[model samples]
Target: MNHTQQLVTTNPNLTHQNQVQTYNTLTFSEAWEFFFQGKISKDKLYSEVRAGKIPHLRLGTKILFRSATLETWFQQQELNSIR
Candidate 1:
């Protein structure tokens, strides 16, 4: 009946919650501010989202962009720009 035993004997949702905590999702505005900075303007960011070129998650009316995926996209963009 200790802490470890209590967690092991209890609800499984706690593990799932911990899994979810590891991922970082950002809003469109936050994603641009954090990742793009001076590289991409706000207008272009919204345009890409509207054009469906950006990877995103739609939850109800809100949009979320994954930090990892956005970083990958930025790397791709850099590669493309060199060519």
Candidate 2:
């Protein structure tokens, strides 16, 4: 197997990051791994979602987040931190 294939096998999250744009929304796990790059814990993410502190949608038992929404949110976070 080549390097790309090796990476895919070793880190499934890389595959999700590559394919994130193709979807309109992302599952909870995919959103954190792709956007936060695992900088934050899953519990933090879940807490944000539960508290409505993050941009998200609820489909029955599943939670979904939009990449565009998160991109803007990150920018806002940066701006807030500068103040």
Full-model lDDT for every candidate: 0.70, 0.79
Error of 1 at 70 (Å): 0.4
Q: Which residue pairs of candidate 1 clash?
A: none
TM-score of every candidate? 0.62, 0.73
- How many residue pairs clash in each candidate at the backbone level? 0, 0
Q: Write the per-residue lDDT of candidate 2 for residues 1-83, one digit (tens) a residue.
A: 66644654476565554655544677898788778879999999999889998989999999999978987898998999999
Candidate 1 lDDT over residue span 1-83, tens digit each:
55544653365665533432344787776677556654788899888887999888889877799867877887898899999
Q: What is the lDDT of residue 53 in candidate 1?
A: 91
lDDT of 1: 0.70
lDDT of 2: 0.79
Q: Which stretches in model 1 have alpha-carbon errors above 4 Å?
A: 1-23, 38-41
